[model samples]
Target chain A: MRKILLASLLIPALALGGAGCSGKKDAGESGTQLGGTVHIDGSSTVFPITEAVGEEFQMLHRGVRVTVGISGTGGGFKKFCSGETDINDASRPIKEKEALLAAEHGIGFIEIPVAFDGISVVVNPANDWVDHLTVAELHQIWMPDSPVKTWRDVRPAWPDREIKLYGPDVDSGTFDYFTETINGESQVSRPDYTASADDNVLVTGVAGDRDALGYFGYAYYAENTDRLKVVPIDGGGGPVTASHTTINNGTYAPLSRPLFLYVSTKGGERPEVREFVKFYLQNAATLAAEVGYVGLPARAYELGWQRFESGKTGSIFNTDKARSGLSIVELLSL
Target chain B: MTAGEWRGVPNLARRHWQSLWLRRLFQALTWLGVMLLAILLFRIARQGAVWLDWDFLTSFPSRFPARAGIKSALAGTLWLIGLTALISVPVGVAAAVYLEEFSRAGRLKTFIEVNIANLAGVPSIVYGILGLAIFVRGIGLGRSVLAGALTMSLLILPVIIIAAREAIKAVPQSLRQGAMALGATRWLTVRHHVLPGALPGIMTGVILALSRAIGETAPLIMIGALSYVAFVPEGPMDGFTALPIQIFNWTARPQQEFHGLAAGGIIVLLAVLLLMNAAAVAVRHRFQRRR
Candidate 1:
């Protein structure tokens, strides 16, 4: 009876304590009277860039809070279209299905190009039998039902060792972009490969095996160049290596793609959202380089600011097909 | 024969020496395993001791390694385990009681016994896929804490049931016979005798199962738990992430500092699991002392 009485008393006391804790958190924002929350979610590939921008934005506006989440590109679109998030970070342009869903929900979005990324095909540093690969070889290796199995299968003069393939999982935007550009269709590729949504895992897998080949965002390869070797690709013009200059100048061919941030126009109408998006565009070039991605040219950033400032809505590229091999200038013109 | 007895005595002494050496060898192997674990703990502590702080515990996750915290993930793990224990304990314990006490030896009992054993061994990732299909999408739970907990409950349910069954089986059969012989019904005998006697063992198994649930990341990942959650969950339907997922997200980053953060997170997770196990042992001790 004494224990029961103590428990009864403690339950109410605990309830009061919980209420007091919540009150403190709620009172914190009202004390400053300065900020609202900004929700951002999307591609892991673009996560570093967004996270950097969010950190700076939050520091500038102490009254504001920014939350960034990584759920891959497709997962972000699902939330963005349903009005769950304010901004969506995408590595590739929005697909038609996603755009239609957003339209149906009355979520008008402005697409802004933030940086240039080259999808790099990498091999272990110890790999000695290959220097470069043609687009045809990448296709033969990646295409579904293709019979390419060994290093010698690609070329008779190459080593006869079995080829170990590793790459991004199907959920990744990088996977979709690579497949579309190399295999002539999005989401079309062989089922046999070690895949991970995390680029570091793919990097480790390739780095551990001499016969392995994998591809991911250039930023990952840049960070782990000591362990992995980047392979140049021949795109009918000639073999070209992936670099800031090559990707930005459109010399990287087929693999050079611009990264994007899609903001909900409804979210833009809010003052915090407007200020944060403005801060993002103004500082993207600097922050992009800081995070290992090549920043877009000043003019591109200016155009992006103009588009966001003017309240322009709709995707520039034909959403039915992800437009590959297009320069930033070409995309802007379209 | 009298002369051979002298030789046999020496041979027996030699065999004793060989057996003693084998025992020493096995002892060394057991200590090696413990030494490996100690080395791992020391290495992690050396790397992450400076990084673990109050701010690291309270702050939300950040892109910058210095600013990142596992507050939400820690809270999410608490919510998940609490809900999982609530759902799995009663169901698992009840199932064990029914099988051990009420059910006769039959085909249905044998089938259940075999399947529960198999389910306990099913790879955790398969449970994740099952959770994704049945709870996340089919039931439209949408990656909430409740959905993740339900999936986790399913994943660990088999283990709990198997453990509870063993505890129930260990209850002295004579005690049940005595209660039934004293004019008590089957339910009365189970309630007064069997459950109390098995409670300590059942608690230990349940706690261990929950510790495993707390470390799982794959099923939650498959169900699309966000890697970054700024706010603590206030309700079951809120989106959440767990400590293992947070550690995984941090470890996968290319930056070197995040590796330290992952180590710190691991230390925190181990501490939580250890505390839980300690509590279980304390509770068992209290019950044993009362008896």
Candidate 2:
């Protein structure tokens, strides 16, 4: 009887497996006949864009499987350097330490700037006193060992209430970008603020507290505009809000950073991976915009394609000169 | 005062009042749990009901929130739990039977028993790391459904063994004695009487264990189950994603619509869990009735 029951269960499972196999064969007949898997793992911030691109790419080529995983940027790099993944989606450029690891593994990569993500400073909708924050003011508020305690501390006329701070956790690429841009060093910040890895939790924290000031990806602020008020940042030029146009035009200043896709040189050798990368670059602009990220300029994409086509390996962004804050177009030209 | 009057009059009245208060307190606590669950379900249903349509069940996940579905995730979850159940149930039950009936009580048995209890309390992510080393990298399964299933099996094996051991122990010792006295060998007695008596309990434990496996996300994620799988997995060797991972991915998205979709996924997951629990109840009822 036990054997009979097991057999009965196994039969249905086998039937379902058969159905799934047949369904794949049917899908394969409808598109370009490229067959293989493309594995991508990386930053959660860049996941939406890559997921969108991978979805459309798979629709066009049904036999090609694209699997995108979010293990954060650093974790993804570990796998990428170890040759476990074909592509690494990163919201920031590869760091010096990560580059060394890649070199140690003999894993060369071509960096492709996919999108622009602005780190938007936000406050609760109820607080109306704030207008715009200069880079220096931002530094004063967020810098380590600073003494800004209340709204009056940042500016006398703002308010007298205690100011609450929130931000992405240390593991986040957003946190790294925000800290580096605002505090003049990566991962440096006052330790009093509430931090969360999930942007939604940060959103909720800022939205529920009137005195809360938080920073996260522009997409999050865009999603919760009604509940949150965005503070425009003044970078030497003027106060510019993080809009699509401002971010794309590089007017969003230091807060606007380019997102990237680091393709392994060895994985690029596979025909499926090569074609998928091509598909990704060609469609990244549209898909990135659709997924609430600022698309790179057309010229940037052209230059990126040229670099990929020429089999350019290693990181151009590894140098101090590149880290001095060049736009994607400028960096690509280099 | 008389001894009976001293014991009964005010003392009985105070004891009665205390019992009534305790009953009311316990009743209120139970209702609180039920109310909280109801509120949660109502909120989820309100948000997700509009999104949980036929297309949402049948189609694969998409970039557009309106088109995103749980087809691949649902299928992957079924495959994972099924495979996990197959791998863990026999091994877990055998270990339980050996420990309960066959193994002699000694230092080694006691040590093994204590370790199994300790293993059940270890964090799921630690098992994930172990699974990543043993299955994905060591055995070269490479983030496939088989790797995920093996990891989940490791996670739930202790729970199943403990539960099965309790169930098998519940079988009356007199039945085993009767079977042996009737000239049946130890294996035959265990097979015909002991196991039959314990089957209902073991089935319940197995079903509950599988339900737990169905909801796990961390171990699968550690083994590299991709969140964005547009195609259904055709075999154990294929890469897949589970319901919790998909729901987590949706909830983490910047779009508000995806949050609603996550609620829809949760509803489906809850329904699967409810059905599995119901099956456990039904199986136990049927087997108990037969006995």
Candidate 3:
């Protein structure tokens, strides 16, 4: 009886899988039409915004389905350059080699800024006296071999308490940016911070501990304001709090960054693609702010549109490489 | 016999064309399939190969993505496999031995047999949800390594049990009768003879299950194996990451070096997978030699 049942069940399943194997080629072509499923993957950091946009975008254009996957920035880029996705939401700029791979695979792309952000430093709301910290102090706290293990060690007036930390995981772009700014390199930090890809965990961690400090994308701090304390960084002369005014004025001190969305140029000529991108940039200022991050200036969007139309982006931004612009000291204001 | 003498028809000689054509077609199709598979593996190997290195394997993930390593993740995966083997091997083998050797062929047993088949066919993701509920939340294990291991054990139980039963059932019934005729107890015959012969196949099944568990991401992720860990877990209660988790994390970055790193991580994973399969083959061959 078991033998008969096994034979009856297994034969059809194997046949079906074998028959359906031929359908993979036709899957990518019909994707431009309405009601089609646009499978988007990558960037957990950018997921909320894209998901929010995808949700409303799908509703506005009925029959069109958008599925967003959070695979992280570089992971997303591989998929994007492989032509597996329409738009790649990235937390950082594409590297030169990634562009080369895309080109090798016939994946032409355009980079557009969706919004601005101030990568906020946060702490548990109970840490009262740590309203401001110097950039050097941040270096001391996060550097590989620092003697400061406790809040008391950081400052004599502060409590002699163990300093707990919660931050983005090693894979996070936020961590990348913070490490670059604070350590003058990427991923050089004391291995004491409890890390997670989900910002919510960091929020909860800091919120639950009075002595704990955390850092993540600015939007997270803004959304979970009641739970965490946003710390001000003293660039050099004055301690600057993170705000729309401060971030816009470029005084947020080392935490301010531009958010980007990379779209394949092969599909960029399509009307739906153009319209979608236009909608994204036009609404980015409002939508990004609504999602608790700073928006880029109106002119920034205008310039982006002009560049897209003209088919020229400044060659520097077009390719990723270290240019002879300035030193870290020169680029960042003290 | 001559073809003409056998067939009694002139056209019989020409029928060889049809036979030749069919054989040629089958051979061509088989080679084509093999070639396509080779191409796919080559592409995957090329992509994942660049990321494999001692530095990549040993280091913790960095903001740069490519510099990230799988030290903690490797440790965590090994631990998960160890715990899973501890729980699953005995339960699966015992259930198989009972159903195949001792249990009376009855309606109740038949019903149990059908349910096991059904369980084997259920999607892996469903097992993930079951693991989340039963082991993680129901048992209140709280996203620990133990919780992840328990979920994996459940996922592979049906497959292991089915494989074990098949191995046990394949043994000639004459051997069982011979042992029984010599005044050997039912338990002793099963223990000494049936088990040794079945051990090879059962081990193969368990090894395959372990290999599948190593590559599994969804259930592990659902059970709270987060994307980053600088330190290897010291116990089942500690937070952990796995090799796939690290690979997935690195591959998600847009950095060139990171993509390279991800490719390297894939190479390492494939190597681990291949080595385990090789070990399984060696074990199976050893058992066959004894038989």
What are the RMSDs of all candidates, in order?
5.5, 2.7, 25.0
Q: Name the top DockQ candidate.
A: 2
Q: DockQ winner between 1 and 3, please give it.
A: 1
Model 2 score (lDDT): 0.88
TM-score of each: 0.77, 0.95, 0.52
Model 2: what is its DockQ?
A: 0.53
Query: Where is the poorest 10-residue window by lDDT in model 1 chain A?
Result: A1-10
Which has the better lDDT: candidate 2, or candidate 3?
Answer: 2
In candidate 3, position A276 carries an lDDT of 68
* lDDT per residue as tens, model 3, B101-129: 88998998999999999998887778878
Candidate 2 CAPRI category: medium
Ranking by DockQ: 2, 1, 3
* Candidate 1 residue-wise lDDT, A81-173, digit = tens: 978788999988988899999999999999988887889999999998788999999999999997989999998998999999999988878
RMSD of 1: 5.5
How high is the CA lDDT of each candidate model? 0.85, 0.88, 0.72
